[model samples]
Target: MKTPSDSQNNWDSLREKIIGLGDHSLRKTYYPELQQKLDDLQQSEERFRATFNQAAVGIALAGLDGRWLQINRKLCDTVGYTEEELKNLTFQDITHPDDLKVSLEWFHRVLAGEIRNYSIEKRYIHKNGSTVWINLTVSLVSESSGNHKYLIAVIEDITERKRTEEALRDAYNELDKRVAERTAELVKTITALQEEVADRITAEQALQAEMRERMRTMEELRRKDQMLMQQSRQAAMGEMIGNIAHQWRQPLNTIGLYIQGLLVPGECGEFSKEHLEAGVNKAMQVIFHMSQTIDDFRNFFRPDKEMTLFRVDEVVAKTVSLVEGSYRCQQIKVEVKTKGEPLINGYPNEYSQVLLNILINARDAFLEKKIADARVELRVFTEKGKAVVTITDNAGGIPAGILDRIFDPYFTTKGPDKGTGVGLYMSKTIIEKNMNGRLTARNTGNGAEFRIEV
Candidate 1:
């Protein structure tokens, strides 16, 4: 119905309208979908950024040349450095010198793809001039085109763990040192104690040897004393009549004096009771003194058959008293001193013989010296739980040449009638072999002293 130009215009306008409508409809539908996709992508990107920045482990990207390309907040905080500062520094610059070679070797392995990921526990220099220990994990990153881009590293701070390890090591070392010192001290103390024990044992051995030697000497003296005692008994028996006559002369003279006094009673026809009593008493005293002399001679040679605890001081005192009258007849003075209770276990008769022997020897020594001031002193004392009896004569000291022979049988320093030489030998035998004691004689300044320890 229209001409050609009109038809062309209408077709063009229709086609343009259709095209506009189609464009409008497509824009209206596809715009929202595209926008949604864009928003999702943006959210994903934000999430990734936040996760990277807030990661607890340090994250970093570095080149094969050890240049740092990117560093996260955690990396900066771990090294005590700003992100900008870390970016400017190479990983090698912060790496400990000692660990540098090892770290490079690990990096080289990662780049060669010999390992998927590499990890190392290493030390790093911090910005504050301190050191940080880290567990480092490194991985190589590559693009789709197979081009190696950078090295990704994750570093976890292990300073606290390292410090704890060091503390334990130090404590162990300290304890070892203390143990060594204690061991040394204990060894020294044990050694000292052992030495002391050894010394004591040696000393005891020496003392025992000395005691054995003394016992041997005492036995030898006992044999000699027995022989001398036998000889002295024979000699005394032959001279008994002379000794009796010598001892009875004074007592007989006293009895004669007492009888004369009784004959002249004072003013009473009957005999005076006082005079009679005095005369009887005087005669009894003389008889008793004579009887004691005979008893001494008899007991000195008597063999004892029993052991008893006898008071040593009392025995010595009795022997001295018995010999007092004889010593007074010779004008010799005797002295005695007793201390504590000198109780000793022995045969009383044998001990009495020992005392008598010593007293006779002392009296003879005094008579031989005949020094104007003749004194014999007998002292008894207790020392360290043992009784010590000492007989000292103020007569001339014994001659050194004869001192050792004094206890030998038949070895006399005086005339046969005056000295039998058996007295000291017998005394030593009784005091030691019989009594389980010690006897020693030494010359003093004035004369000789004999000490008996029981």
Candidate 2:
């Protein structure tokens, strides 16, 4: 029933009496040291009491059975409960149902000596029916003999901390969602770009393939042209042989008649040495003439190895003369006219062949048509600094439909036996391609006229 002031006064009086005893009689004995030790123990006990009641965080003692035996002021404030009210309830009664099981598990493990201590975040139901989040640290206070004892729990209010952590988690989840959406869009863009590139590559490859095909076709056409040109040369050679036969026919018959007369000269009273020598000389002269004819045809048939300067008129006249025998046999007359000595720089042999091809073509046309009084008029002249030659035939004009294609290789209107079709084509090739001149055909007054200009 004593008041606090009376109790403090009595304690001070007892301490002063003990010190007075130690100073008067126990100063030289161990009693003064014993009194000093007792004073220090009292101070320490006071400090422990103050610290336990006024600690920053909640501190409490609980039974191994999860009962709360002691709780501090901080714990009461955290759970909105009085110390006496909390003491009436076990920690399990206030603990959230979701966290109760784990809390009990930790407590039992510590009680069983499986672990030294444990800390956990848990929730408690406050007296006001609000959620109180807390960090709980628990340890067992055991006897020295290691027997199970009460549990000591230290708790800190962490409601604000948990709220901050939840907010951060939500914001992070939103950021992750945006990143996923952006990444998906980027993937779509890249895929579209890839498809476009693939399409362009395919188109380019097709274009290249088409180009290769066209090149191959051009090369094939070139090879065919070369073959046709070669065939035209062979055909020309055959024509030369026929012309030679025509030219030699008359002289060979004359030689036979002369030799036959030599054996019968005595019967005619002409077997004298003078008559024999004169006859021999006449046969010798015929043989010489035949030899010269052979030489002329041979030289005309020889291909020019290189270009030379020559007269257009001369080439035209020479080419006509070479075929004069065949023309005569065919009853085709050829007349040559020269207005000027037109000069040309070209392959003379090829030029002669061109003229011969045209002349022969004219004769064949006349024979095919059976035209009476057929004639070919050839004129050589110079116009506008260009050498020009015109061979006009009286064998009737070419048909308009086939005239344009006359110079195309392997194109002809005559029967296969009469024409190989490359004659005029090769003639054009010689004048235009070989000699860089022009060879053209058109309808003139009498018939088809072939014009060559260089």
Candidate 3:
């Protein structure tokens, strides 16, 4: 074996001889391949430079100490600073004071290898003394030995987008305010409409009430007109009766005088006592009949008068006296019983009319029944602090079915010509409404009883 240095030299010489043999052939073949690889590397470098320089987002390489080691043109333009000026300052110099701590904390995290990348939107001061809002993305780059070497930061301007967002929010708020205002206006309008509807309903109700009142008034007027017509007929009948009674008055008086003259004694001035008494009694009967006829006429045409306190017995007596002649002819007995002389306050004429109406009804009842021994009883008394007068007749009783409506206007059991049907109704009105008294009627066992309480 040769020495180690001679062996290494022999190997080097072999390598040189091999290299020398291929110098021209290698130049012709491997030189083109080497040139192509170099061109590919240059092209890749150009593509990287073009991509970095033309990016819209600003890119920067910063040292671990936060100094700008390199910056793209976009970053220089975004911060309004030259590359040389930016390299002289640290990232903390341009960061807002309020954002600086948070940004440094994040940077420290990246340096510690705790986070791969971080992003934040923060405000920064530009070279021209204006504020810029930007979104920043930071990534940590380490050496192959795992030492924290540099940080890559991507910055994007977001001031216009933030302002636009704020403007949109303001517009939405304005629209909401306008909608609320319109809703309030609509609510007020609805309230007004409801009020108007209520007012219209009230007015309609009032109108209906007024119309009802007018109808009631018209019906009352019609009733009054009918009453006037009935009264006219009654007046005419009363006038004819008055004339007939007037015509009989003188002849009846003359007959009474003649009879009385006959009762006087001749020459001796004292005749047989029985004969004189008989003649005098006959004369008395004539005078009584004449007197009753005159009273009937008087009562029939009696005028209305103001209210006054009067004895009930007196009113009853007057009513009975007015119809006595007619009753005497019919053989109807009249019985009167009173509890002292009870006084009542009322319109005397109207009260008299009420009594007269009841008496006439009793008379008609007796005639209709045709009872041989018909009788009418008039009783006056006080009950429950009220003056009461009861008129009862022994005759055919009223039918039970028609009794309830007997007091209604235009209701009567008698024939139309014999009874106007208004007598009881008018009597009820006078006693109840005019005199503030009560009048009622009910059928008894044999006949009917009419009661007046004042």
TM-score for every candidate vs. truth? 0.52, 0.53, 0.52
Residues 1-454 of candidate 3 have per-residue lDDT tens digits of 2232354477566546545646645744766664455456558757877978899999888888898877899989888999999989999999988899998999888888889899999888899978888999999877678877678899999989988988999999999999999999999999999999999999999999999999999899778956743673384356336445654655577776766666566555776767777776776777786666666656555665677888889888876766666677678899999997788888776787787778777777888878999999999999988999999988877789988887777778888676667777778887898789999999998999999999
Task: Please give the CA lDDT of all the candidate structures.
Answer: 0.78, 0.84, 0.79
The CA lDDT at 294 in model 2 is 81
lDDT of 2 by residue, 1-454 (tens): 2332355578777777677765635643757676766568579758866887899999997877777777889889899999888878999999999999998888778877899899999999999988989999998777677776677889999999998998988989998999999999989999998998899899889988988998898899778767776787788778888988888887788888888778797887768887778778888888898788788778876778888999888778778878988999988888898997889888988898889889888988898889999999998888999998999998889998998999988888888876788888888888888899999999977799999999
Residue-wise C-alpha lDDT for candidate 1, range 92-113, written one tens digit per residue? 9999989999988888887788
Evaluated against the true structure, the overall lDDT of model 3 is: 0.79
By lDDT, the best candidate is 2
Relative to the unseen true structure, what is the C-alpha lDDT of residue 117 in candidate 3, on a scale of 0 to 100?
A: 94
> In model 3, what lDDT does residue 351 have?
84
Q: Give residue 374's lDDT in candidate 1 (0 to 100).
A: 79
Best TM-score among the predictions, by candidate number:
2
For candidate 3, the per-residue lDDT at 99 reads 91
Ranking by lDDT, best first? 2, 3, 1
Q: In angstroms, give how far residue 154 of model 2 lies from its true place.
A: 49
CA lDDT of 201 in candidate 2? 92
